[model samples]
Target: MTYRPATAAVPDLGVLTLGVEEEYLLLDPDTGENLAVADQVLTTLRGPAREQSRQEFRHSMVEMVTPVCADLTELRDNLVALRRSAAEAAAAAGARLVAIGATPIAEPHRSVPDKPRYHAMSRRYGPVAHDPAVCGCHVHVGLPDRELAVQVCNHLRVWLPVVQALTTNSPLHDGRDTGHASWRSMQLERWPSIGPTPHFESAADYDRTVDELIAAGIMLDAAMVYWYARPSAAYPTVEVRVGDVCPEVDDAVLVAALSRALVATLADDVRVGVLAPAIRDCLVSAAHWRAAHDGLDGELIDLRRGGTRPAWVLVNELFATVTPALARHGDLEYVRTQLDRLRDEGTGATRQRRILERTGDVHAVLDDLAARSRAG
Candidate 1:
């Protein structure tokens, strides 16, 4: 897609559109096991919804991307309609659509999709490719300038852990509690390119690093540069890949709203000649690990203070930082309410653990995820 750069003048927050891509697993409702029926499910979608959806690396997974949305309400409607359509399609194909981050129950094997790229990836990555299926929510905020997008990523680095903490839904994997809020995060870190993005000096520096990784055979191409945040290869936007796939539409929208606001606030900082903070890479990685391990229930590494603080304290700080942008984009009230709901109801990981604790059944957890996913 051809992208035109924004004018010299700093654009209003409203001009930065939002788009979300969510990956989901198809499961057998009765067995609570993954069902490799993505092709069958795809055939059931019609028209624009079909165009918006596609099969992922695994035959048991399907992904849906929303069209560019001017505001959160439009994004929510698009997501709801897409989820409803996909859930119905899965039902037609004799499977249930689930929005959890990773497969809760152990599966004997997950088949790669019937595509040349997927087959090549499976061959190259081996066990990493064949691991239990995992899903993530990728949020894209409009920024046509690649240089600014790279800078925005630098500004976004510190907030990655906070966002990940809010959307941890993969606490259980391999039929047991993995003892991590986002087991999917740990699973994805096996890839060499996955983790916190380095502080790039400029767009050239970012491109050079990507080229070097590809040349060294660490990644197949630019698309495999799976840092938590990066300049999106497919679109002219900064793609935030930190969060697991959220179970409910409200959770997804809350993440999307916060992501867009963060981008807008940081873009303004870039325009005003603000330099990105000089945070140590090692500390940032440590902070992310803590977010994955404890989610919102424990202390997170305090990047600014050189110590740990309650996760909710850092979350509130993030909100304070982005409040101006949120208000400018008319998302302040919605974000506030959603954050309240999150505090009261807990993260998806917490909810899943509660169900397992109360019922002592893994299948019950899967059932709840399936029902919420279809609730759209």
Candidate 2:
């Protein structure tokens, strides 16, 4: 069961085409419980136009696959259309499709999708794969060859935590405010292959390590190498698989644009042999921890500065780092406007906490997230 890209050859790798893939949980609108009805939602979405909405490993979750978009505007438009289709289907199934990274309600133990790989995961990993309803956003940036792509991932290791900081949408897990911005990432960390990957010297080194893992039965296949960023198994692009799934479509646009710009900047650096200084995994992990624990409102470990700074300051530095790349796509103003709005209004993570504070009801957070998602 090998999956390949829908279109193999990309035009002009210099332009950096991109595709955005997002996973989401379906919820009962009233109680905010994860409804095991993704199949029903996907069934309602059936037809030539609705192929982008598909099943995930969990029965309560669905994935949205966007077309290979050229730029941010097209990405936003396609995401809006896809979300509209998914919302209608979910509504028809007596559920609301949420773009949240993790469900707030205490998740009822539910069945995994009836797939051989999923069944095997449940059998082997038990609760981690079957416990909570979690979702993520994956952004694929065009990189023609595996070597450049692997290099891009290696160079990206240092800043991935900062990017993840801006999109921490899963603060509450299993009905408790977990005191962290993205508990979905914590659940993800349960997997052995999950989290940041070490630097690989070359594409062969990357593939060879994966081969060893598969041969040793540590991973089922090449697709199971769950690095924060890696060469896509099915696409001629490097996929960044971190970040909690965002509620608003525009937030998704912001993440995608920033991520693409970051990757592009790194790819350029790789070509010039001017890679950023590599921070060891310990510091990288600590920076990520601070990012998740405090999100934007609190301080974060500034790896470049070797000290802690407010996340907003760190995030601003991130934009500065990739300013040239964002400008290349004429997305500087758009990114600036969107990121400013995200900072002012706060991400879904901060907003989720505010909602809980205001209503004193965890369910209100879900309702707000669902309404915001469905509205877009």
Candidate 3:
């Protein structure tokens, strides 16, 4: 899904500054059925007040955004408040909201809203827009410049799959276990523009390639190039849109912290003339497939050392690499603590399966997710 960031001006903060956007699936509190109540949710949030929340491609999906924040505590507070507000609104509207990768069992929502752009998208994309619900988390981290953003995107290739492995929460599709950690990752690949991007020599080269894609009709606009990592056209930050919408609020915070630290470390490496690792587009695809399939419970392609390794090993290696950057932002301890919690609870995909095992009902998955989402 494309993100149209708000046009309000935000003061330039340091590289450690961050913002996160999370999409949630609105559901019936009792039946676990997807409910099209985003309009009501937004209206409630806007009770004589302006809010950053907005609609998504599906009426059942709504995105809550946080402002530019400096640390994890501020980020946590903003996120918790947003989730609470949305949940209260959903309850008032006779619905509920949950943060998961995809709806295990949901009716297809084919009716498009009366918006002109959505109408055009439905016409251009056909039945693809009518598919069942999917939600994701996008983390935006401030960057020094567009050139550095391009370099960071290039540097981020091999690590993309590793990160995906960490956040694989969507395990069910169409009411059945898909046998994959993040089914949404695979589902998203059906789109031509939603994958790892090729290396660009510079910011100008990246812009030209975008122009060419639009010229060739492969993309509708800059907003349509939904690469896993890209320079946000609407902001000065680099937006990383690879992970599924995390099941827990702290999971979302962990992903945001790691993303910000990764960009800061990579950009500093570029500034110091350290050589950036080279990665091929095909290898990147292969790596992503591995992560989307196995998550941390299985092996992963070690993009840096060029071999296969357990996802746990790969994650520890990454933690070591980004430790200094995390220290720079005073995020090291929080990152580590949150990661431990994630591992102990199992990624969202594992939890979804566990819920199914316990309750012997598919609806239990959505029920549990909604409870956890609101509890935060």
Candidate 4:
């Protein structure tokens, strides 16, 4: 299949169009276990007045992408509507909806969704690829040009793990502590061309990389880039694919908001000929290690200043750097509130561990995830 370009020319620096695509697991409403019934839910929600449906590799997992949102207000409303429609449809079918980076204990042996794409993935990726429990948060932000998009991606490589750190929602997998905040990140790292992408000097360079990878038989198309951050093959945006599945819809919005600010700031810098600081691969890997080991509580490696600092400190610095743009975009209050909430309440990764410890019931943890997901 031919893969179309992921970018289009946007004339001005006017507010960048932003949207988020979330993957959710379909589960039995009562038991709260993964259920291969997304087809049923899709059938029920088909011919929709609001949202549209697309196919996924697994019938148990469905993806929802909001329309292009001009600003934060529209983004919020769009996501709320999509979540409500999905929840109502799933509930009507006696199925539950859950948002997590990776389901806590999904068994790979459970029937694959019986879909052709899933079957192909199973055959190609074998066990790790066929894992029925994986889910993710994909945020798409507008780019002015393809070459600039490649530059943004090159600069974004170091900070991709930082974004992953903030949205570490999957701590438990296979009914055990996976010893990582976003275990899905660790799990997906097993795949070829996975994790942080390399620096691309221009659009031509990006195209050549993909072509070479395909010619080498490592990938079939541009869709196979599959890096934590990549030029979206389907949308005119840069899709940040590093975030774990968010346990709460609000956190999902927070992650998306921050992503927009980050991208916009980078674009401005690019326009002014100010490139992002170069952090070596060793230090970048160390930051990823810190995020996985300590979650939000861990200290991250400061790539620029070459020192260590608390993750929240880095988050605050990031916000401060982007505050001017946030104020201009009228999203400052929302971003501030979100950072405060995460700091005060902790992330889904921390919350999952706390809930399991307090209740000592895996089912209770799953139930809470589903409940929180609907609170949007």
Candidate 5:
């Protein structure tokens, strides 16, 4: 089905709704290898959850999206349920679930899942498609006005690196560093439709851009505009599609919380007539560089000040700036605890590296993820 843009005449966007999609790698618990078994698993999963299996291309490449959520509580509950069901479903099919950004054990020639859409992409993207080893967590925040959506997307171009730095879950690709914290980002960037988006002055402008891209044969439609952040064609939302798929559900929730808070904070500022100064393209470049290089440890360029700041420092500032918004959304405690967990423990990438370091087997990392997911 084609997508339709949301109208700007809708009421206040403050009444937030959340939708999240998590892409997972199918794994064999014993060997930690990427296994093309998602289809088998979904078939074995009985009950209402089985309905999702028929919703899209599935099995080897599984995607679970939460029902449109009215608030954070509902969103959290949906996430927990989906994760639990996925684990159960995987176990039933003699497979296991590991929610890293990309599986380290993936090989380019490892069999691709046999789905029509998968086939289409492979036919189009060729060997570049073989690296479909990556996974990601996408969070959707409602946009009350289409015009404001463009503004939010423009400002988002500057913040994506921060999210990437915080959620660098793919430190290893095909069992090597690949020199990128999130190899999925690098891999996905190869597509013609991926990258930062240009600023659109209005909803009509955005429509025009999409039309141009489609006419030029660059993409099929708005859904193909796979920027780090952009207006959603499927819903009245701005979807942030950057971060690597986080292993921990808490980490996912934290990222979603922060994203919602950031968008809402920016929207509120717009409501009150606050204008952000134009950030140079270089600052955005530096921001992405910092994220790709340092992950959590490296310094990120602060867009507002045009200076380098510790990644965690920027995270802290984000938490602080969104405190009031979090309170309003009734997610302050959840958001605070999630941030504290990252601060006290470490990011998924950090924890995975430490685990791999101790055991010297990449399988141990997968096992650890599977164990935590079960506990959650």
Candidate 6:
């Protein structure tokens, strides 16, 4: 079934401002190998782009954050500019900025930056810290109160797998198809606290759980909670950290629009005292694994019902659920068109596999990713 936009009048546009944080890997343009020159690349950025960009835990990776955007159009423009500036900086530093979710070509040893926190993580986590050079897209929706953010997380839990399925960009790792759409998601499972956020009694309960994890040495700090959706430790937003960093600008914009609309809808539910669904955590985790394995190319667990359904069907349901919010934010038609485009071209994983199947070369996949990454 097709998604229909809501007929409600648009609401005030300032309710839930949104922003995006995307992490990327630098690669040798000719060899398609990971390059450990993030520092050099950062030096090449100027003005606002440089301010929004920072080095990630791994020396081979960099992250670009968009300023808080009031609407999807502003967010898209910021993302396009950020990607252009980042690609230019990487080129200046003798590398290509590719937005694939994980490093396709493996390196013998990946280096951590010289920061104390990064070094401590490397020393403590050992192979877990060193092995995977994965990246993800984090969407932050404005919510000032921690209690409301926690409630919103509960509302968001059921749809996390669907979100992951929509943005599965990391199919290949170490120059091989890992038999999974988002290998980056699998790689994160090794971490201590990384999955769907649990149902919380209140914001206090959430804080206590985080404190307990830290006290038990399961997490380094609040920032390391790493749940798929959580009250941001650094910001007043509910940060949804489920999706792989999308390959194309349109994909990222689609994710941002859906995420903001979802948050706005769920927050309204919270205001009206709608209870969160009581799905089993194990089931949610299983659904996540299924999404990581198949992306949108196969069926996904239908949480509302008892059986699995095609991934696109579930995505349609999500759009239906959040239609009013989409309409309020002036994103209904844009999201509709983008969803059609996504279905036509396929998810990033599908595109990557298609390139590999046709060309029989991993470098060709990287070449396409670099070109798309720079494209507006």
* lDDT on C-alpha atoms for all candidate structures: 0.90, 0.83, 0.83, 0.76, 0.75, 0.89
- For candidate 1, the per-residue lDDT at 138 reads 97
* Per-model root-mean-square deviation over C-alphas: 3.7, 5.2, 5.4, 4.8, 4.6, 4.2
Model 2, residue 180: what's the lDDT? 90
Per-residue lDDT tens digits for candidate 1, residues 87-172, read: 99999999899999998785555778779888888888988888888999999999988888998999898889999999999998
What is the TM-score (0 to 1) of candidate 2?
0.94
- In the range 86-205, model 3's lDDT, one tens digit per residue, is 888888888888888987677556477779888877777777767787899999998747877897898888788888888899998777889999998988877767898788878899
Candidate numbers sorted by TM-score from highest down: 1, 6, 2, 3, 4, 5
Best by lDDT: 1
Per-residue CA lDDT of model 6 for 104-128, tens digit only, reads: 9875447788888888777778889
Off by over 4 Å in 5: 1-11, 53-59, 108-117, 280-282
The true-structure Cα RMSD of candidate 5 reads 4.6
Model 5: per-residue Cα lDDT over 1-376, one tens digit each: 1223433344465557777888877787777777677777777666655654432233345777887787877877877788788888888777887787876776433445667766776677677666556788899998757778777787677677888887888878766566667777767767888776666766799899889998987775567788778888888898998888888777887888888888887776655555545766666766776686678866888887778988898888878888888888888998888778887777777887888788887877788877765455
Candidate 5, position 219, lDDT: 77
TM-score per model over all chains: 0.96, 0.94, 0.93, 0.91, 0.90, 0.95
Q: Against the true structure, candidate 6 has what lDDT?
A: 0.89
RMSD value for candidate 2: 5.2
Candidate 4: 10-residue stretch with minimal lDDT: 1-10
Choose 3 or 4, whichever is better by TM-score. 3
- Which residue ranges in model 6 land beyond 4 Å of their true spot? 1-14
* Whole-model alpha-carbon lDDT for candidate 3: 0.83
